[model samples]
Target chain A: MLPDSAPLSAATATSPAEEVLTVEHVSKSFGDNHVLQDFSLTLHRGENLVVLGKSGSGKSVLIKCIIGLLPVDAGRITVLGQEVGALGHDELDQLRTKVGFLFQSNALYDSMTVRENLLFPLRRHWMADRRGQEESMVMQALDDVGLVETIDKMPAELSGGQRKRIALARTLIIPPEIILYDEPTTGLDPITAREISQLIREVQQKYTTSSIIISHDMNCVRLTADRVALLVEGRCYAEGTFQELQQLDDPIVREFFV
Target chain B: MNSTILAETGAITNFAWRFFRHGFRPRYEVQELLYQCYVVGYQSLPLVGITGFIMGIVLTLQSRPTMAQFGAESWIPTMVGLTIVREMGPIITALIFAGKIGSSIGAELGSMRVTEQIDAMEVAGTNPFKYLVVTRVLATTLMLPILTLLADAIALYAAYIGINLKGVTTLALFTNNIISTLTFGDVVPAVIKTFFFGFAVGIIGCYKGYNANKGTEGVGRAANSAVVVSSLVIFLLDLLAVQITSALGLN
Candidate 1:
């Protein structure tokens, strides 16, 4: 097996960088069922790392633990050099401003318009002196996502693909340093999924944001990922570039490629 | 089952503590608070008015024959005035408020929870409790008494109408009798209890909704549980208020 934290062959795109997020020996269990056991991974700055897993392989659990939505049973998660569990509530809230999360459902506030959605993060973090700049920042984010026309519309009025785009725009509004994408392209047609994948790459390049993308879609993995990690039975079974992992002879890793 | 009950109680207590803690911070949600007040207070006036009107008419009609049988027919104004003012007005109005506002808050928050809107808010560095729970709780705590006051006024008018339909008491005489019967002791205790009623409704609804799980079905469950618990809590609080008021000779 390749060594842990192996540099991918396509590492030419991103410059050498320090670690941004580190999940070390994290273990989680629910009653009698163990979800994640001894899982460790480090996310380098300004690289797209796609985590590939099967349907019930605890991908969402990992994301939840990282964001402190769920507490880990027996390990530590450090984001931006701060231990996730060590921070108080307000501190965590402040830290989250720099770490954006794109949920699988888009999680757009249905009660809010697209403009309101974009403004939510800016207003919540209490970014003062954004009077005139707020409008332009919102416009820029919407423009980046190519959905400036949807500013006045509510999330319910948007299609599935449009909702995904708007959700990404909401995350990008604040220009977070690290983004955690939970199944960014799960519930869409292939065309839309491909488009979302391309957008993910565009976001990574444009913002130079380090992202940990958890997805099962091969097309998404192929288009967005600079490195791929195979999570089997709650552990990182292998890690390499898309091409490196694609040529593996192991059946479990081969199952994904075939 | 016992563990579940204990866990739930503990959860609600923690939720209440966090709500108060978060409630006392900056970044206050002034717009949302005002909007909730308008929703929980202003929009509920019509329902509370109709219910109060019906209650006045019915209580007057039902108690009339009994008062007449006791050779106390002339005491109709005093008796109806006291009953509606001291008990019926606050209790019935509070129950109606609990049903409408409590269920609405619960369902709204539960839907937000299931759809991950609450998570989104937290991730975006917004305190959902301060924005959603505190504003709603404070609105109900402050508005229920006002609504009860309005309902009491409407009910008194309907009582006046009820009296006119049967007897020939002048408006001045009816007004004098009501004013004389309802002392500060009677009105103050009754009104004071409604604040508690409002607090209970708001807190229970928020607790249910914010902690709701089990997906779409949980939304319905939260709404249902909110109404049931708040309504029950209202009765229990009414009983306690009566005892305290009686002990203090305010009844």
Candidate 2:
């Protein structure tokens, strides 16, 4: 079994004062059932912010809004100094290159091999100089996630943990300024989950990339979060460091730690 | 119920409008388009060929005894040729095309949507609509008519074999009879209507697949609805084409 606690390293301790992404009072609803209501959060230049919530508590919706996948019903989501809601289709697509998203399902293209999957974004953004170096770039990304051997394999051939790692590698290939991970550690064995948590930390330190990870897994939250925001009933019910939130006396906050 | 159907029709029209708009603008997806054409057109030829052959033979055989009863057995070549050229050929081939191509496109796209592959494409800065929808829709639109034409030729050959089974006619005489029976009006209008049939199949498949909701079940639903809708649209369009052709004295 993997250790339940992850002590923060020195590199992740000092985040720059610049805010990279801000969700200011954003709200979204599907018909009568409102998923997100005036929820708000922020990510600094280099930090891992975890949004903790129950299965249907609007965490995915929040991420969708930030990525401009779903239009917000109210409020503003600004990413990399531009309002996400204000951009046109092409503009939003351009903005997406700077921000990577890791889906809970991994979302690796079923039709493609690992190398092709990694090459997808690099080619899409038209990084002209990446032509000769594309092979090396793919190899290096696979190397980062310690899956260089699986470079030529299809996604379906891998185990769930391996698939997750490959998915992370695919995202890291483009090296986005901020990465959004949706349930990064769910549906994994404890050891694999712990390893992914460590990989997440390694990615943060190496790339100095900010991340907003959505998860209900307390272990993932404890291991990866620099600051944890508890999303309760479509709002940020509480916000603090894991240790700070762990020591809170309130029943709602304490429920997670216990 | 009426309102729901109207809403669906309105939604499909809007979807079609988007397809037209994005289809023209792009760093066009040439590679994907070629691959789709290969899959949709080349792969479907054998099935279309076999169906065409059977349809031709069956129609010839069934019409033989009836024409013989009317002492018009010698007119079998002309009658069969006209029927295949004007109506049965396009409608049967289109319905078959709808069943094969439409359902396949719908299921493929629906699977992509449910698995979030489409969303991943968007988030990765590739236009999913351009890469997936446009390529597929265009492939069907172009491929269906070609398939129908090929099917019509194979069908004509089978009809010839059927005619030769009981009575022998020289190829020259058979060719002359068929040529004399079928006017430019018969061939042109039939061929023209096929393009619309092809477009309907492509567009309906794309629309249903693109807009499918739910999960794995939705994939099946999209495929099912695509065939149903495209087949229906094919008949309706055929009816309208026939009416217009008659009005213009083309038939």
Candidate 3:
């Protein structure tokens, strides 16, 4: 197990070269219930960091805080060099365009069709040079998820796996510098979950985008994680390469593997 | 109980403040506002129309015997017309609007909140408040007044039909009698109050829905409370409007 004070660096042969996100001694609480206490972790450029934790262990809270949906009670979060809490609404919005977040629920808009849903973020960010190319961009995003045929369908019409893929496609459409996956494989079947995990890996390679994936799904962690950080009681207890973490003798870490 | 009410009032007021802060800024959601207008105004027509017609007919028929007993049957059109335009049209339409649109906005936003769709919108670089709340509130505020006017017209027409159902009063005479009784004071105050009614319904619905919690159950609560609160607010606003109009010697 790595020291808690040190940054969670990958022990793999091809090491992470740059830092894209840093969570330093972050603590968040809802009233007296401290969900995270002095939690610290860093996401490297072009590497997948899976935060492994049990249910309701502040995994989702961490993701929300990073995205500025929830404010941290203490400490700082730096995303692509800008302090998360310090950014204004418009500035945060500008930063958000560079970072993609995939919610566990997929969070596809029920009122809009897939095409409109894909166009929502694209148009909202309003990349002036790409105005007329919206159709092609949407098609490309759909093709990435292999759901181009379901482009016109509402979110309610898609299957669970399809919805997850479409949600991923929506994130990928903008080609963000970093992608945060909050339990990407939480509710899917084993095969679908594996497919999603593989897709996560493929996205990392294709875009060379850094990612922080929150998951208790071991298979997903095994498939997608270049490095793994074990969150225990609102702290980064230990972190290492997935294989290195597996070889560790710590019982708290072993509990996750078993 | 008082503290809870105070807390809720404070929160709603804060929500309103946020609405004003973001509502008038550039990058206006004109398309969403128009769509919401169509939904809030056009789609609500059939129900509001039927209610107005029935109200007009019922008021006319119910008052006929009383008017006959007082030898004032000739004054029925004037009486019904003044009542519909000055009170019943606005209050009844606002109530119906609160029941339908208020509940809808609450449920929709609550569901979106629970499912993280709202956060997704934020992450997509779109202010969900601007896109959802402001558009909806603006739609209700602008559309409610128009809907009230339409309801008043429909009810007056129905009252005319109710008059013709028994007596053979010509359409021209009936209209003239009703129009002659309606002053600017009667029309303007009632029309002005409908805007407040609409704003109340829209803001309350958006507030409940936008702040909803506890998953699906929270959504249910949001929708339920939105209708209840907005309905209550409609009556309160109507009372306040009456007081204001009376104070202005428009009564």
What TM-score against the true fold does each predicted structure earn? Answer: 0.96, 0.95, 0.96
What local lDDT score does residue A136 receive in model 3, on the 0 to 100 scale?
99
The candidates score, on chain A by TM-score, as follows 0.93, 0.93, 0.95
TM-score of 2: 0.95
Task: Give lDDT tens digits, candidate 1, residues B207-246.
Answer: 9999888998999999999999899989999999999998
Sort every candidate by lDDT, greatest first: 3, 1, 2
Give the 10-residue window scoring lowest on summed lDDT in candidate 1 chain A. A3-12
lDDT of 1 at B99: 93
Every model's DockQ: 0.78, 0.79, 0.84
User: What is the total number of backbone clashes in candidate 3?
Assistant: 0
Shift of residue A57 alpha carbon in model 1, Å: 0.7
- lDDT for B71 in candidate 2 is 96
Q: Write the per-residue lDDT of candidate 2 for residues A1-258, one digit (tens) a residue.
A: 212222212133454589999999888999998888777888998899999988988999899899998999999999999999999988999889889899999999999999988988787677776777888999999999999999889988999999999999988888899999999998999999999999999999999999999999998888899898888878877888888888778677777788
Highest lDDT against the true fold, candidate: 3
Q: Which segments of model 2 are wrong by more than 4 Å?
A: A1-16
User: Candidate 3 lDDT, tens digit per residue, A101-185?
Assistant: 9999999999999999999888887888898999999999999888999999999999999999999999998999999999999
Per-residue lDDT, model 2, residue B67, is 96
Give the candidate number with the greatest DockQ: 3
Using TM-score as the yardstick, the better of models 1 and 2 is 1
